[model samples]
Structure formats: C-alpha cells, structure tokens
Target: MEPVKFNYEYSRKIRVGFIGCGAHAFRNVYPTFDYAPVDLVAVCDLNQERADIYKKRFGAEKAYTDYKEMLKREDLDAVFVVLNFDRNGHPLYPKIVPDILKAGIPAWIEKPVAYTAKEAEDLVELEEKTGQFVLVSNKRYFYPSFEKAKLILESDPFGKPVSVSGRYPLTLSPFQEELGKRTNLHWFLDICHPMSGIHYLMGEVKEMCFIEHQPSGNVQTLLSFKSGAVGNLELPSTQADTSPFERYEIIGNKQNVLIDNGMRLSYYKGSKGSGEYGKAPSYIGDDPTDGPVHWEPEFSLGQIYNKNLFLQGMVQSVNHFSNAVLNGRKIERATLKDSLHLTKIFEAYKNNRSGKWITIE
Candidate 1:
C-alpha cells in the first residue's frame, strides 16, 4: 500500500483511550498523537492526579483511575497500553491485555510482552477467542533503515536471506538458581530492540547455541531460523558508553545489507560480475544498479523524519496501529507471533545451561 500523508484537521481520527500515564508514554508514545490520526478520548492510570494531568496534557476528554471504568464509560475504537514492570520484572500487559480484549477493545502495547512464553501463548489464546486485535509497539521493526533493507532483501538481486548477524550493547544479569525467578528479565526488555528487526526480516528461530563472557556475563548467541537461515546475536555488556548501540547485517547469496547505529543502511545489489576478479581493471563498478545503495535521514532539515517520532519509529508505529483501526484493515506489523518468538529467545537465555545447544519448541 502507498503511504498516506497525515492530516488530523482534514482526515477523520480514531476515538482512542490511553492507559498508563507514565514517563515512557510521555516521552515516546503520547507525542506521536501530533502526527497520527487519533482523537484522544480518555486517559486512565492508577493515580488520579497523573491521569488528569495526562488528560489535560494530551487533549483527552476524560480521566479515570481504573481502566475498566474508562472502558465502560467511553466508546473507544482502540486503546494504547503502556505500563512499568511488576515485582517480578514482568510487564502488566499479560494480565491487562485480556481485559481489553474481553471488553471488545483492540490494543497497541509496549514490550516486553510477558515474563515467559507460556504467558504470551495464553494471551494469544485470549486474543483468538475474543477476536480483538493487538498491535505491539516493537519500534525497531519499523525503523526507516531496517524497513528499506527489508524491501531490498525481498526483491530481486537480493533473493532470500540466508544468514543474519546482530550486535547489541546489553548485559545479562547474574544467573539466579531459584526456579521461576528468572534472572533474564532485563535481557528480555533489551532483546526486543534487535529481535524485533530480526524477526521482521527473518521468519523465526528454531533453536540456538549461546556462549558467555566470564565476568560481565555478556553473551553471543547463534540462532537457527526455521527458514533455514542462521543468525548470530552479539551482546556486548562492556561496550563503551560513547559507541553506537546497534549494528546488523544479513547475507543473501552474494547480496547483503548492513545497518549501522540504527540510522544508516547500505544495501549491496550483488549479481554476477562482467569480468574476472584478478583480471578486472579498476574496482569501480560500471553498472550503477549493481553497486551498493545507501540511505540515512538528514538531521539539518526541519522535517518529520528528523524528529524522534519518525527517527525512533514511535510515530510510524502509532500511525500504523491507528491506520489499521481507521482504515478497517488487518493489523500484521506487530502481532502475537513476535511476542512468542521473543519469549522463546528470552527463555533460551535463561536456559543457557553451559552454553549448550537448546531447541525452542
């Protein structure tokens, strides 16, 4: 589908309610309303003061301390759910999402989806039963650079992706022995960034073999995808603070694409060359299409792409969910499949017993 220009004044907006008036929403989710086609109808939070503040700040007509109360009182097309962690480092969505579905309201939620794969699977069952759609806010999958790379890989010349590699700067908390006291909770939160992009590009992981760094507990994992593609995830806990947080590359035969710092993308349009490698004159390519194509947003301009909404993918993601509801379309970008895949990977880390190979069923 072709991209539609956002115009709140000219276009109709979806009547939506928001839950969790917290810092994350204030910084990332709520600001996107300026560009998205959404009419903020109500705001809900545990704190009446925070809910009222958010209502006034974001143009919501009503404020409710109870989301169930908000759902009952307001006629909403969809709801945006953003909340902090629980005592177990698990997000509240696993419990709250079912309520939204039961009330016949669709949701756009943030990660991590749940503490375990079982919880995500249970949510999926509820989603299927309720027939209410959920669009997860996995922003990395919507990043402009990665989106372009995905298009390049899917088309000709690139063919099918055969292998993948991702580098993210994060640490695994020390392994805990207590059962169900998973020490990889923070890892689950951080892995969402890289896994969102990888799962969007590659299909799913069949299983993985992980290795660890002694002192820092940093890990490097080899992920085997069900699509027969292999991948490596490099988690560098000791990486310098000033260094870029992410680097990714995927190979498809001779064609490949590389993403740097989540901002720059280099797509190599590889094909059979005209001349021999050693016998060729200059290394410069005569064919423009066969060479590498690069893309990165220009920050100097006062453009929407320059802002965090577009830059960090918060805007496009919200726009995507809003478009699904407004256009009466099926939402596919952020689904329960991603939640399941990510949970399996998180579990794999928790099950990193001696760095041996582990199959994710």
Candidate 2:
C-alpha cells in the first residue's frame, strides 16, 4: 500500500474553490479534503445560506452565491463542481464547467458530465480550445478493489482477460421512447457507476445489445469490447433493499477474479480440485500456491482503508486532482475522454431498442 499523506503533511497544496453545496457534496466530496492536499479558498451555491454553512463547516475562507464572482475574486488553483441535476434530469456540469475552464482553472466535476454524447463532445472541444482539463469523477477507476484487480489481470499468472460480468441495481421505463427523453435519464445516468468500472477494466466498448424484462423493468446488457473481450451487465430491479448492491467478475484464460459487494475480492487460479473429481478425499487442495487468494477489510480496526470514503475512491480521486494541479502531474484516468465513452454508451441505450445491437463510435 502506498503511504497516505494527510492534508497538513503535504509540502504543497492546491487552493480550491468549490461550487455547489448540495447534500451529496456535503456528505461525500467536501469531507475528502481532510485527507487530501487542498486549501479551501471559497464555496459557491445559489443558496447563500447553504454556501455559508458549507464554508464554515469545511474551513473555507469565503462563500458566495455566484461562482463567477468567486472566480473573479479568488486565485484558485482548481475547482470542484458537485451540483444536482435539473428538473429534466440533466447534469448541471456541462453548463457550469466551461466558465471555470475559461477562467483557466482545471475542474473536477462529478459524473454524468452531460446528458448526451453531443454535450460531452462540446466539453471536449472547449477543453482543447482553452487548454484546461476536467477530470470527471468516475470513482471506480480509483476504487482499490478494481485497482488491485487491474494489477492481477496484468500479471503473468492471470493470462489474458477474455470476458467480464457485473451486477447492479437499476430501474428503466417500459416505454422504448422514454429511454431517449432527458426526463427519464436520471437512473440511466446514475447507472454509469458500474458502466465506468467495466469501461475502465475492459477498455472501450464497440457494440452492445440490451434486453429488458417488464413490467419490473430489469435489464441485461451484452457488451462487445474493442479489445475483443465480451461482457454482461445485469440490472436486476427486484433485489431486496438489504441485499449486496454490486458485484463484478473478470475471467482470464482459465483463472478468474471476483469482487463481491464492491468490497471483498477473490481470485481463483484454476487449481486442480484435490486429487480426482469424485475420488478426492478432501475439497481443500494440497498446494498452497494454487489456492484462491482473498481479501476484504477488517471492520474492527479504525483504519483509513475501512472507511467508505477511501474504499469508494473519493479520497484518492480528490488527491489525484490536487496533485495534478499542484505538482503538474498528468491525469491518466477519469479524463474527459473517459466521460465521452460513457456518454456514448448512454447514447447507445437512448437511440437503440431492446435486443438490437447498437454500435458505439
């Protein structure tokens, strides 16, 4: 594990201005600054009361109702945007981030970077013109479980990753035309959590086909990756509320890795089962090296790894942006390009029908 540096221990810090003081930011985004190298200079929201409260609660220097005013007054190294969606279920980032980029400030915007691929493409154009970058908060790229899985997949023991599967909870409208309406896109946009993870591990998807089971509206989407690996993503809407929310598996030549409930990880190495299939005396194998390796955090300890903020990748994601701003480190993940791929997948769903393959450009 890499050593973690607290905010005060860093030699340099990025002076950051925060936009939006909503419930999500209040709960997840702002608190990550405690573990990251950030100097909170200002916060902005349409509601002055919430902005002021967040400023005081998060130890920022100032608060403003207008982000443009905050941008004019503060010499910020970067900005964090975590706004809620509009009434139409469209994310507010695409409309808000161009101004921050125009101010020559790099931004870390929460996901659903846009409602459509065209909107994401517009942001890409602005990024090139202004020479300012935006890192979309696709936390799965930073999640430790996926990170370790990535390393294992690249190791010689795992061979080639041939296929992948994931299960997540999502509800879709029964009407085919409803898929394209911005009003119905909230759940689809939010489902990017698993989509981002699959894209990160499998690379770009070339084509996809989804079948929906209604009136429950459960869905299963089949994916064909550009790397030639195939994938299946299950969005079963009938799971119990108390059930484990997500699971993912990546299969190699003979071995496979599994992530259960987004926390526990098990890697099966295709070891021989005891002696013979039915003649084995014990199910446990004799060779220690061939056994499956497993890992999960111990809840008994008061460790950073045990915390949801770290486990879910919020701390590392924030740290990456801060380091990129302060140390001039290049962002290799969660780029606008990644957002483009995600949005393209969104478009695939929006424009295509069930059981028909849609090609992603």
Candidate 3:
C-alpha cells in the first residue's frame, strides 16, 4: 500500500504557539510540525531556559517564561498545551484553556483534561461562551487500526456491533477514599488512553456495572452502550512484566476485530468451510482475504510509519485539528463533548463502589 499523503500547504499556514516545553512535547508533539500545515511562531514554559532551548531546537522565533505574556505578544492561530499535572496529578489544562479561549485562539490540550468532572464541564461551558475550539489529545482514537475499526462498525459489512472487550494494565485502589483522592491524579491521567477508543468505537455509554477484585487490584466493568451493544473492560495491574500494555476486541454480528498491543490487528469474518476430522488437505485453502488481515509496521526502512507520529497517532490528530481550525469544519472525534463523556467515565470509576452500576447518560 502507498503511504498516505498529507498536504502541508492545505491552508495558509497556521501561526502556532506552544505552551509546554516538557519532554513529551519535545519528543512527540513538536516534531509533528514537520508534516503539518503549521508555522511555529512562539513557545512558552515556566522555565525560560527550557523554553529558549525548545525555541531554538524546534525553530520557533520567540520564547517566553510566562504563557500569559506569550499569548499577549504572539499572533498565534492555535496553541498546544502539554503541561504536567499539579502536585495532586490533576491536569492543568482546565486552568490554562480558558485563558487561551479568552484570547480568541483554539487550543489542543493533552489528555485527562481536568482533575474533576466539574472542571471538565467548566471548560465545555467556556468553549460555548467563547465560541473557540478546545480539543483533548486522545491519540488512540486517531490510530489507523482503531480508525478502521470505527469505519467497519459503521459499515454494513459488520452488521451491528454486539459487544466489545478491552484490556489495559491499570492499577485501581479498592478503598473508596483512596480512589477519590487519586481521582484527579494517577487514575484520570490514564483513563483517557482506553476510554477514548471505547467512546469512538461505541457511542455514549448508557449504564455500566463494574466488579473490583481486591486481592490483585483489578477491575472488570460491563458497559451497555446506547446502541444496545454490551462491552467489558479488564484493568489488570498484575500482568507479566514483558507483556504489552493494552489489547482490544470488538464483536459484531458476522465479523469481529482485534487490536493487540496498539499495533497488530486482526479481523475474523468466520470460516469459509467446515473442516474434516483428520483429512483436511489444506487449512489455508478456505479463503484468501477472509483469513485474517494482520497489520504491523516493518521497521526496515526509515519511513514516517516508524516515527512516533504514526505510531502514537499524533500526526493524524494534529492534522485533523489543523484542518478543522483552518476550514471551519466540525471535528469528527476528540471534541469537547467527547471529552466530557470520557471525564464522566473517569469520575465514575473513582467515586463509585465496585458492583454499583453507574448511568452516564
């Protein structure tokens, strides 16, 4: 297959400013500008020295120690906020996003939008008032495999989705108070990683029942979607050290899909013919395409597919955001409304007790 083409000159280059100069942005975010329609004009961080270093490294023209000052001086079309969490592990996006919106600039914030549901909702309300866009960087939904899964679910080939199973190694505390205290911190920080894919594959969840295993600090959640599809989430924190971090499977009427370790993908459309007891001449003779469509990048070549943008879903996500801002198009995924739903899910896991079902609708 040919590499997907992205037109870097799609629109008049957007004058972009960055708010965080942390390691993640340095490694994953700023490098994406190479393929996107962005003119990085300025960057700001609390540390002037680090900001200056990024400005020089990423070819930005200006750098500042304060975001407010940078916003006032720079003529920016958009800003990317990759700031770290507070002492409580609560993401600082809610506090910074309002200021960016008030400054009349669209913003793309890193995941786990805020520490609490209320904080997330506040940002939603602010977007409505300011008429500016604020998107969370939920990269899993931007992945090619998950993107294909979404299209398959919507297409008639899969009929209708019946159920889904997601596996992620995340630690959950059984104690209610401990969970609440950790709500805005470690728990919410990672929930967006899996929940983003869930909301994208299946629409808004209507109700959910979860059971927590105390001994191993694992959680099993059963979710019923508004589309009458049921799903399960397995958050096992006790997996082997060498195992991958995540896995997912979605079952439909006649077809099923699985994404393993965020890279390998398989689609099972059922067997073509029944096999004999012992005289099956060729097991591969059933069907050519229906067998299993597997996908994983070959790292032999120095290609963009091997880069973090393609692997971490950063390129497509940033491209999508840029296109929406440039063309006045509505975003299909990672909108504020989607973030709101995800925030509620994180809160439910934090506040609700095991075996107590919660309604998110």
- Listed per candidate, the RMSD to the true structure in angstroms reads 2.2, 1.7, 2.6
Clashing pairs in 1: none
Q: After superposition, how far is residue 225 of candidate 3 from its true place, in Å?
A: 0.6
Cα lDDT for residue 315, model 3?
A: 83
Which portions of model 1 show Cα errors greater than 4 Å?
A: 1-4, 177-184, 270-281
Q: Best candidate per TM-score, number?
A: 2
Candidate 1 C-alpha lDDT tens digits along 1-361: 2253655663688899999999989999998888788889999999999998999998889999988888888999999999998877778899899989999888999988887889999988888898888888888778888788888888877889999999997777655666633474554476877888898888788889988776686888899999999999998989998999899999997888999999999987644445786887656577756688788888887888888778778888888888888888768787877777788788777755646888878
Instruction: List, residue by residue over 1-361, the lDDT tens digit for candidate 2.
Output: 3346887897778999999999999888998988888999999999999888998999999999999999999999999999988888888898899999999999999998998888899999999898888999998988899889989999998887889999999886655564443236587776778999998888999999999887787999999999999999999989999999999999997889998998889999845556766797766667767888999999998888898889999888888877888877657789999999999987776666688898898
Residue clash pairs of candidate 2: none
TM-score of predicted model 2?
0.96
lDDT of every model, 2 decimals: 0.83, 0.87, 0.82
Best by lDDT: 2
lDDT of 3 at 321: 85
Question: After superposition, which runs of candidate 2 have C-alpha atoms over 4 Å from their true positions?
Answer: 1-3, 176-183
Q: In model 3, what are the clashing residue pairs, if there are any?
A: none
> Better model by TM-score, 2 or 3?
2
